[model samples]
Target: MAFIANMLMAVYQTNISDLFEVVDYLLMLKAPSFKSVYKWRLEQEHKLRERIHAESNKTENSHVMTDTEVWDFIQYFQRITEECLSEMPARANFLYELDDSRKIKFRLSNL
Candidate 1:
């Protein structure tokens, strides 16, 4: 999805306060959407190369990002997110229906 690509770009390129806000959402994608994400990853890798060549540094880290950081982040996030999605509902708060006319019920989990 384009939204996923944009969200990753924002988190990768900007100093967002929420360190890993929407990472869980990335778990929803299947095989077809992989190319968009792969493209973004390629762009980040290219940026890392350019930064290295130009002697550019970001903030206090003395580095921008390694080629594997994003991939590793995704791998870990995917595992944890999958587990949470499967198990968190059992630990969720009990939610009550507000009105008798409404049939649907759900708990709002943390993103």
Candidate 2:
């Protein structure tokens, strides 16, 4: 049970780390404001850190995980990663559209 729990934590940490990296990449694209993205990224990172800390505490307290529980957690984590991955293209497109709108507004203002 402990081994399974550790494995689940490892899987979660790795996949979530990858997701954050992808988010950072998405934020690098031209956007109207870096402040919002930076704030959001910090919040996400804080939440991730808090979650990891809580999980570590639970593990250290010897909370056992049944095989079914482990399986369920793995499935949940995989789904979350997939959802994040699928949203990346949409986010990129939105950023592009935002940049285009800003350019159009600037041109209109000058005219």
Candidate 3:
């Protein structure tokens, strides 16, 4: 049972990580307007916060993580997303001002 629980937690973490990766890739395309990107980021943040709150209240089979641990994870991810979102306007401006001769490289090092 412990092994299964650990496996489930691992899978959950991977899925969340992958979702963020997809979002990062989409943002690199800059196909969506800045407003749309900001909206999506806000939505994601809200969803994550809700998940953390829900998890914190769980009592059964709570070996996956303690409430404090969940809060820490939430804070860490929120800070990362906030940093990325804060830089979006500058990145968008740079992309807009760039000519065909120049290309900008987007890095997800912060993640």
lDDT of each: 0.48, 0.48, 0.49
For candidate 1, lDDT tens digit of each residue in 1-111? 569767876775575336445444322211222333444665777777677767754334545556577666565355334554454455434332222223334334334
Model 2 weakest 10-residue run by lDDT: 102-111
Off by over 4 Å in 2: 1-31, 58-111
Query: What's each prediction's clash count?
Result: 0, 0, 0
Runs in model 3 deviating more than 4 A are: 1-28, 58-111
What lDDT does candidate 3 reach at residue 11?
92
The TM-score leader among the candidates is 1
| Candidate 2 structure quality by residue, lDDT tens digits, 30-89 | 334433334444455556556766878544434444445444545544544455445544
lDDT of 1: 0.48
lDDT of 2: 0.48
